[model samples]
Target: MAKIVIREELKPKRVIALMSGTSCDSIDAGLCDVFPDLSCKLISGINYEYPEHIKSKIFQIFSGDATIKDICQINFAIGQCFSDACKVLISEFGKPDFISSHGQTIYHYPFDERIDNISLKSTLQIGESAVIAENTGCDVISNFREADIAAGGQGAPLVCFADEKWFHNKNIAIQNIGGMSNVTVVSDSCETFGFDTGPGNVLIDYCMQKFFNKPYDRDGKIGFSGKICDSFLDCLMQDEYYYKNPPKTTGREYFTKQYIENALKFAPQNPEDIIATLTALTAKTIASAYERFVYPNVGINEVVVGGGGAYNPFLMKLLRTYIPKHIELKKHEDYGISSNFKEVMAFAVLGYCTYYNIPNNLPSCTGAKHRVVLGKITKHV
Candidate 1:
């Protein structure tokens, strides 16, 4: 057996944080050592892409109208994936003290309005944490969003607490572009507000899968080689969702195949041109959001880009053109944290907080009533 040393403070406490992102790409597993009082040190992080067949089933089931039984079954099935991924990590790095799984967010509707006294506000993150805990022989914390929503918040942009703790600077906007693009403005005053800007890779990914038969546009090769279509850009910009005020959140639900089809209907364009315009759409929306909310409020001197979109050169170039030349543009990796792993590592940190009864949600980011400790715990026997 390989030699292993557990910190005296964390003698029997380890945590695994798992996430299946909106991109529908893979399962990201991060393992860490967390002490009794919520201090965490990441040990390892890895990703497990779903087999194509399984991925197809999940996408099909989650994308549109589906029977309630299918939804219930897939929840357990997603948990099994998390459990399997954790098992692999345990075999490679050792069992954990606990697990924090973000699960797969199938639906999240965070708004409630009423002319009378009736309103509906709910969010669902599927994947059975109890099942994962049972399978892994470790305590688990999952479904980390409901509490924030109940407090009258957007119940999203959850990555801000991690951003504040790990990457916040005096005058920088931390922009994370995953399936959706979101920005967190951190000022010298220490005030922060983060909301999803718009679709990140979701639109681009949809276009690629339709036109090229690939999951993603590999390093944006296709977009780089294409020209923007003005008509499509005009059509897509018409979405009222794009112009909505802050405290808003969206998902694959908003930027779906149907949405793309509608945009394409007004102005039919070639596939390559469509990709370019979509790529520009992400860049422009991100830049515009920062200019409006972040720069005006905090006066940004630098923009720190992160997440999967940080790797897209075409997107980066467009961002440069859109933002002021005086501001520096860079990736989060320059700060010693890998952009791709930051969110996965964040859940690990949250797991530590939940274990120690520390609050993880930032009220400024989520617009919650107050800073409340998030996540529901399922303990190991």
Candidate 2:
């Protein structure tokens, strides 16, 4: 490789990041002022739900039934949503220096696939950068995962790049229980490693949508009303993904709607029990991950959780029960960041890193061959 030097005289700037995680529930925008010291102040955050029609189309495509034409259309369709979000966020919080769009992850296939002659691994997160750049009238950064995957990595659980910055001194575990749960163990020495722990809100939300006809378990009320089925919990515990080593990632592909349906059948046909069991499973899997990978090696003393699960009290209660007594559990907000907006904020930081030619993808966490600058930048001409 040829030598290339990045000028180190860049100034701190305001960045607006837009994200739609595996949940496919909504697009969230966060305006962040990122400083040289790696500190970020969230100027503002706004949430926008996808129109039911667009959401249905996206989900249908996710199910693998959509044609290539559908993928092409939704790629820009989602970008329009992101562009609109950026326009609104700029209006409310003033225009940022740049827009960092994490876009919508339609599919994340992390495993190795061998084709005709060679082995390949890829991950896709789509939101057309040109659309964002044109609509928002600013530079845009998107597709942050492809570089890591190109270097033979899982291309996921990428937030540790920002998590280690947040807890540089403490032996902390930052867990984001979004559609899928992922854990990042950041040590006092700045050694950070992470992986997908397993299913997070995805399963529980399925239970709620199926049984209660609600989008999610409000404060995990349904779970609180029911008792956990030990048998079902044990059955879930035996799943191979939990035992698989780190440097791994999973998505809706494995834990599909059918998986949830099958799990409910294994239980005693009570909606509450099913949800409670799913909640317990999420907590236990996280605790198991800590016990197996993090605790023995890093001696982590704190578990700071974020994502939608942070708002579910019963799920938090289950987490408290399953995690060790020596480790204190707290929400990301307890540390001065809003739980709902942290991911988008992290992307802002990642975008900042990319613009400055700084390496943002942590090899220790993503299992990449080496650290690399992430994100593809689209400059407005």
Candidate 3:
């Protein structure tokens, strides 16, 4: 392990942010320079796909009923993967002041009751930061969820920090369509609000893999080629998950294989129609959530999209139909932030914030009782 001191001449600072998303497909790494206060500049980013076996194992614990020991072992292995990705990032982009790794979340269930003083609510993110620090010789800040939990917050949509720093405007809906979809209401006063809207690419990917033998409907081609089943769409729209208010968060746990099975019971016999229906389900649910909760309150003028879902033209088109003429629907790329790499950029910023002892979680978004500094530090000592 190596410890590197910050040069006095560097005013703000720099860090590499790494995130392995819910999809378990790969690791996203981004290098960024940040001002001491909170400004950010993206330097470089790349995605590294996991080996097939590791991918399978990740899906196993995440989707399966793995025990505690199973999870602990996987955490260390995932950490090594994180460290390897950091190595690749530093080799190309050079060193940064610190590293923030979002690690990989295997399960997220925010709703739980209390036993004694502690709430049973919990979320799990694998990938040990210490391994990352030891292997990369860079200080690492990670486990961004604990502080939010301590504050009684949901510990989600941490990307809102990136939204505030890079995309904030008086009248924009910063929509990030990741494995899940979340939107941030950005206004001039810094009083921002965001939450996981619903399923983003997660359901789409699940449907495509189960039926079409594909990872995802690339560019939403299959969805474009298929016709929507109105009945299926209607049934999906009625799901209680859609009606839940803000401060809510969900994951593969809620939208499980069981839920899909139930939805499929009424789906059209044709798998293509089912795919179209699921894609429509995602787009409509997202748009509906925005129109219902965000538009009236914030009076949105722009919808800045990010995450892998931004690549789906069909989803984008569907989103446009629900928004207003006064509002703009576009990708983060249009705002100089690559949609695919934005989350990576966020984790980098979070790492820098954590290292400087800056508080990063927003109480409004996570419903936590108060603001708290997020993450644990791992030293290369």
> Best-fitting candidate, measured by TM-score?
2
Candidate 3 residue pairs in backbone clash: 17-348, 152-368, 153-368
Candidate 3 C-alpha lDDT tens digits along 147-264: 7986778888687876777665557888888888888888885478888888888888888999889998899888888899988899889988888888788898888877888878
lDDT-best of 1 and 2 = 2
- What are the runs in model 2 whose C-alpha is more than 4 Å off? 1-4
What TM-score does prediction 3 earn? 0.94
Q: lDDT per prediction?
A: 0.81, 0.88, 0.81
**Model 2 residue 73 lDDT?**
96
How do all the candidates rank in terms of TM-score, highest first?
2, 3, 1
Evaluate model 1: give its TM-score. Answer: 0.92
221 in model 1: Cα distance from truth in Å? 0.3
Residue 232, candidate 1: how far off, in angstroms? 1.9
What are the per-residue Cα lDDT tens digits for candidate 2 across 1-381?
Answer: 334466687688899999998888789999899988677899888888888999889889777789999999999988898898888877777778999889898888888888895666777888899999998899999899998998878888788899989888888899999999998888866478899999999998877887889989988899999999999999989889998888889999889877777776688678898889999999999999888877778888889999989999999999999998988999999999999999998999999998888888998888899878889989997
| Runs in model 3 lying further than 4 Å from the true structure | 1-10, 116-118
